[model samples]
Target: MTKIFIIAGEASGDVLGYRLMTALRALRPGLEFSGIGGARMAEAGLVSLFPMQELALMGLAEILPRVLHLKARLRQTVQAIAAQKPDIVLTIDSPGFTLRVLKAVGANGPKRVHYVAPQVWAWRQERVKHFPGLWDELICLLPFEPDFFAPHGLHPVFAGHPVLESGADKGDAARFLARHRLGPEAVPVVLMPGSRVTETKRLLPVFRETLALLAPHVPNLAPVLAAAPGIADAVAAYTANWPHKPVIVRDVQERYDAFAAARAALTKSGTSTLELAMAGVPMAVTYQVNPVSAWFGRRLIKVPHVAMINLLAKRALVPELLQEQCHPEILAATLLHLLRDDEAAAAQRAGYAEALASLHAPEGTPSHAAAKAVLSVLG
Candidate 1:
């Protein structure tokens, strides 16, 4: 049996990792998988070395308190990889943790494939200098990434954006509405604060306030909070006192159903944007890192827009209300505009179509393409 150790640090990575596992298994069944992942990967039968949440952190200020703990996890991971001695190590995203694992395993160890290339091209372009020897191969999800890394002596395999195969556009809206006892008249709006606890805690209150401000204008506003994996109970507790308690969507299918039923979305800037766009749901992206992280980010971030949809469009297709601009009133106003204005919503949908067309792989589904890429690395 060929041993392939995999690691994924975030909810999004877990999903991507799970799909990759499924695809790889189809390509090579009886391949053994170990290493770290979350619920989805667990479903794919990976017994994680530690709780993946320990590495699900983001932002400088957010991660500072967990620095020592993260370092320990890093050491533990490297030691685990060394002991396991798998034929190949697939570290999915979480560059803070995965990249270190790749580097520590080194060129001398098992061949390393870092799935989901880090966004070094967006900010801190200088950091590209250090990426040369970290992995034997890099798997990139975006279309533009291979060109970005190629110039730097890194030949990344483009697996295309995984969101294309996510079944986001296939959600049954009638089933979703009937499942939730929501009427056709009810305006279902998806509230995706984020996948991380820090993001959920930070953004949910603002979402609540936005709902409060929006309730009067929108008739029978049926709110749905698309909770990320393992956060349903926490999301339940966090949203207990909201203006209107949202129907908390737990798993992938439910989240897609919610996406289908949703008229619009108030979401954090990330893969969720791509998912919403794929579902043809209009959205306003919002995010906040603590003041210190924001301060540093302002100086380093080279990109004008944070939403992946907008970034792919190479212009602001969706409204971005980040940091100081992520106020409840602003969120309510932006969402209201999307809901009430058909022309504006249609314009965004048109842009989404134009941008998303670029995300398809040169070959089969993204996971299949990625599986092919990983297998090629094995040879």
Candidate 2:
């Protein structure tokens, strides 16, 4: 029996970890699986060594207060992994926490396979130089990622973007509009704050303010808030006092449908940008961090654009409003532009093709490709 210990620190990583676990089960049925993950991975047979949320902390400001707790979890995780002595130790995303745990595991640790290569190309280019010694195999999701890591004595296998599959099966636009009481003639703007509670708390107010700014100009604007899983109640509570409450779509299928039907979107800066692009929805991306964190990030971030769609396209496909620029008026203006200008919307939608093509996998599914890489490392 194969012993596979996995670590997935957040919602996105949990989803990917679940998919990879299912694929591994398909290849080797009797494998023993244990890890740190959320609900999705729990359903995929991961008896988490610790509550995954303990390691889900992000951003410098957010993580500062939790340093002692994080270090404690690190020690706990390291002790667990050492005692288990699994054939493979797979860490997915959350480099801050995962890498520390990996370092503690030492060189003699089980075949270390890391999924979702860190964005060294954007910042911290020096990480690539040291990464070759940390992990045994690197499984990347982007086609161009291998070029960045391979030259550093690390052979990365491009398993295609996981979003490619999730984006493929979307809901019906007509069904979504009707269910949300949105008329076909009315303009619908989708607001995706983020999947996490912290993200929702940070961005929902700005999104709400942005919507208010647009309401006067775009009459009868039907705003639908796409509630990321497990955070629907938080989204609702935050928007409870609004003059015109945004319709919250919590269902997975309905959220995708809402994306398809939306004229434009105001989303946080992350995977949602790519999700909107996959749905061919024009959007303006916005993000905010603690002022000190923003100041630190400004120095480290080398990329011209922050959105993945723009990164893959090597140009700005959509407007990005970050930190101080993520104001209601500015965000609303760009979204209003997307709603009003067909030419601009069409141009942004056109960028999606190139971005998707860049994420296209050659033969196998991303989960299977990732599983193969992990298995190869174990052998």
Candidate 3:
């Protein structure tokens, strides 16, 4: 029986890690899995060494105080890898922590496989330079990523975006509207603040204010908040004091239905942008970080846009409001424009199709492709 150690630091990575673990298990039924992951990975049968949320942090400034703790965790992880002597050590995303772990594991440790290549093409192009010494192989989500890493001597396999594999992209808008007791003419706007606690705390107030601003202009507008499963109650509590209580969507089917029913979306810039795009929902993306973190990020980030959909499309297909631009009024105005202007919204929807076409895998699904790549190293 082969032993596999996996690490996934954030919610998105946890989801991807869970899917990958299930697929890997399908192929090798007796595979022993252990890792640092969240609820999803634990549910998928991993006996985690530590709570993955401890490493869920983002931004350099935000992590400053926790540096000592993270250093200790990193050492503990390296020691775990050595003691376990797993056939493979797979890390999904969280390049900041994962790369350091890989470096400590060094050239002679277990076969190091990194699922989801770091966004070197977007920023810190120098990251690919470390691949030869660190990772034995890379599994990428985007179709265009392999070529980007190949020139740098990194082996990259396009596993497609996990969103395409998830049936969540498909929806029944009419049924959704009826289920929610919403009228046919109600203009629903999907509000995805984020899955993280910090993200929700920072963005929900802005989203609440935006909803209030839109009330006068769009009397029939329905604000739908798509909350991630574990944090549903927290999301509810956070928005309880708002002037308008958003129609909170919890279940997977309901969330997708909400996405389909949306005339537009105001979402945090991340993986959800791709989900909204997959649902053909035109969106205005925004995000905020500590001012110091934002200032440092601006210097390192090479891309023109922060939204993954826009980045992949190689153009600003959707409006992006970041840092200083992520004001309630600006976000509301951008979303309002998308909702009211048919031509602009249609254009953005068309851009989604074009961008999505580029993202789809040429052959198998994401999990399958990723499993095949991982299995190859074992052989």
* Residue pairs with backbone overlap in model 3: none
Query: Could you give candidate 2's per-residue lDDT for residues 225-275 as a string of tens digits?
Result: 988666688788878889768988876678788887888998887777888
Q: What TM-score should be assigned to candidate 2? A: 0.95
* Candidate 1 stretches greater than 4 Å from native: none
**What lDDT does model 1 reach?**
0.91
Candidate 2: residue 167 Cα off by (Å): 3.5
lDDT of 1 by residue, 234-320 (tens): 999878887688999988898898898899999999999999999999999999888898998889998888899999999999999
RMSD of 2: 1.6
lDDT of 3 by residue, 56-167 (tens): 7777776888999999999999999999899999999999899899889987888889998898888888867767878899899987788898888888888788877666
TM-score of 1: 0.98
Q: Which candidate ranks first by TM-score, i.e. highest? A: 1
Full candidate order by lDDT, most accurate first: 1, 3, 2
Query: How high is the lDDT of residue 284 in model 2?
Result: 90
Which stretches in model 3 have alpha-carbon errors above 4 Å? none
What is the alpha-carbon lDDT for the whole of candidate 3?
Answer: 0.86
How much is 168 displaced in model 2, in angstroms? 5.1
